[model samples]
Target: MLLVDCSNCRRALELPPGAHSIRCAICHAVTRIADSRSLQPPPPQGFYSSTHQHQPYYPPPPPPFTAPSPYNHAPRGPPPAVHGRKRAVICGISYRNSRHELKGCINDAKCMKYLLVNKFNFPESAILMLNEEEADPYRHPIKSNIRMALYWLVQGCQPGDSLVFHYSGHGSQKRNYTGDEIDGYDETLCPLDFQTQGMIIDDEINETIVRPLPRGVKLHAIIDACHSGTVLDLPFLCRMDRTGRYVWEDHRPRSGVWKGTSGGEVISFSGCDDNQTSADTDALSRITSTGAMTYSFIQAIERGQATTYGAMLNAMRSTIRNTDDDLGGGGGIVTSLLTMLLTGGSGGGLRQEPQLTANEPFDVYAKPFSI
Candidate 1:
């Protein structure tokens, strides 16, 4: 009998390697067998494979704490310092020929690069970009190059060092194999060659980026793509309503109310919720195309002086709503606010809201957003 932990109840159980699922005698919750190595739970129903597929810009599908590794590990170290040079990796894929072609993905990368340098003071030499239009094969946003770029972002990271990883393109969800995701889905970023190169799942991302991060190091991920929330799998999620009220959702793999936090200071600003899609729009007229989240982020920073995270979040939401109104009508009242807000900052319709996930608790207004 193979002894494994149940994905739901966190109880150890014995099962046959060939068995696909078994009922936990302890909690009695039926769990799907994740793998032969362990009795992990299968992914939540509806996922096609371990990767999210591509579709048009329409709809799409799809964290962290170190308090305790639900997968069986120890708590992480303390937070990193606030002083160090900044490094960044920005990727934008249009999937030009495929059905998943996007209008503003490439522009999104360029815009982000511009914002980092002009607004955030990120040096050009420390920034590496992977766009589909690039002539250099090494600079293309293919799976191999993306992985290398990820490694490059975290490589030689020290306390107080600031690292940024941004991906503006399609995102999908796969069946959870490691049982790391509570929702039974592993979010993924589609590389240009995803059909042949395979999607980069959240587990691989966390292991590559999050696990290796030492205490005091900081990673700020800006993901502007469909179903991007929780892509980094950070432990805490920050949600703000239309009124700008903030609530924190603990996403640690462990089953606790408010456990501890991770040692490294990693934060992610995603475009939308797991079940929502991000928009690639040209709301700024010919100013250039851009992902809704990227545009709002820059606009929020530019709208006024630096403020707290809560204020920034509200500003972004308002911008998205106003943009939606400017473009043409409703969808801003619901969760799909990002596209509408950044598209033109009009006041119409509702949309999926943006999400901010981090490893430890923080003051939403303490520090202004800075590189």
Candidate 2:
């Protein structure tokens, strides 16, 4: 077992046996890496008896990443094996009170699970999927728990421990006192209680959970919601919605707090904008392409078509244009998530994939992502 010098209590403590990660025994402040190898300390029962090292929370493992239903090759390898102690959480909530609404969310969770497992090879045990139905014995209902779990994962995260957080659900704008609905910066995962009681607000999500994460972790978050039709050019807007034609104008104010990536190193995939609706349908159930923005994001990452984050988004938006007739969703919102991601508040030129090679692992330099 590795040891960590709890920055909180300033005491050296041995980590729990087989513990992939743990919070400090004293202040509960998280540790990014195990203690320096030169010094090994006694177990947690030592001098800091009052300091209790709480087990960091981890959400449940996502649903098995099923092989593509129609693919001929058998996943190109064995069912993904767990790598180290990396973790992944998928929260899907599609079935709601009304059958017509069929608000399918967390579907991207399964797709994300497959992407991490098969493509990235995150360890099976470390990968966590938290659906509305799944119970995380180590976790609680608050999104804060998930966020803390993620923080711990990244804090103690090793080279191979990749963290992927995927949420597939509805996007909405909460009306502020100013009489304008603002895009919730801290997007939420639709829990089972979402219909009865809406999920956590983006504000609470960013403040409570996101603000405290470690600085450098390979964490990626994808929200298949539309954050702004203005940041990214809107594809096929429904003529019925009368949502005036999407102008390629940039709406992010230079001084607004919401303009930058506050989530830190975590790339966000918003479904639709503050004023738009991210549509859902059973149409792609028969097609290979995931019509949803999040799924398409995963597919782009998987096929290596979109290498860097920016390139990937460009490819996603292009897919919408190419398959506009195929997906049949006018507004072709496929690249909506990527738009907000790369723009970083400014709608810039197309981003080229970072130079890469077979000898070098895939690396993205998208100016450290944020929600």
Candidate 3:
């Protein structure tokens, strides 16, 4: 066995011979290490020269340099670990018997709940799951109940805790009244009783979930719905083209109510853009229906591959593309999920390019992806 360092997560581990790729136990980053011996530190300077027979001329030493100030700030520490107290709010709605009824939303919520508890180590008691099939009225996906759950997900969110919010259902776009939205439309998550209870607007979601989180807390939002981009009102947005190159934009408008980072780290994965609609399909297992975004998300993780933020987004996109292909060709869709994710919608010549956005600056690949 040989000790090797993980390039992405920086964890040192003993490598078994003939292993080409290994997942980091610390960050779960899968990387191909062809030669573990290459990770060894080089010998100290002058060791080779001193051992040589030939004499070499020594250059004059440069003047001594002053050390950096103690007050000078050092780089920030790694992100908060998910091993801390974890909480999640997962809402899945089929809008049963309604005109906008879906088939896979309820299943999406349950799948996410399972993944959180079994794979991510989230506590079952801490997870609040709301689905349309619930017999209890309070557990229904009503506007007020969803809002309360959103609030509950972030309540008591400490520095080390990992918070997740997932919504799989119909999404819509309404005219922006507050000029906070750049596209002249505010993205919304439709509740079962939206006709009477009203839709959960983007601004309120931000105020309820994103604004209150403290520094060192990590919020991972998986929104498998339409018009989900910027739903969390995070500050940054990353857009990637087919070439895998990406650009970041400041999404907050100049006079927006919520303008910048709230000292916490937020990453949102959306099913589609502000103008597009997400798909509820039955192709996940041929017989069982599920939200396309949710299916791809869970599939990407279940592959047990160590991947960066960018790589994970690409994997989800690839799965979505293949799923669309199996469903017969429609429009040319490019699906990618962002921290503030933007994905392409299928059919009707509409595109739902998934996107990833964040509150603070982060490396897409250098840092290992976590809950």
- For model 2, the stretches where C-alpha displacement exceeds 4 angstroms are 1-85, 96-106, 132-161, 178-189, 226-264, 284-291, 324-371
> How many residue pairs clash in each candidate at the backbone level?
36, 32, 23
Model 1: residue 309 alpha-carbon error in angstroms: 0.9
- C-alpha RMSD by candidate, in order: 14.5, 16.0, 22.3
lDDT of 1 by residue, 248-276 (tens): 87678754422222366788888888888
Question: Candidate 3's residue-wise lDDT over 260-320, tens digit each?
Answer: 4457788888987777777665334312466777866777777744277877777777766
lDDT of each: 0.68, 0.41, 0.68
Instruction: Between candidates 1 and 2, name the one with more favorable TM-score.
Output: 1
- In candidate 3, position 84 carries an lDDT of 42
Candidate 3: count the clashes.
Answer: 23
User: What value does the lDDT take at residue 318 in candidate 1?
Assistant: 64
Q: Give the TM-score of each candidate.
A: 0.69, 0.50, 0.69
Q: State the TM-score for model 2.
A: 0.50
Candidate with the larger TM-score of 2 and 3 = 3
Looking at model 3, residue 353 earns an lDDT score of 60
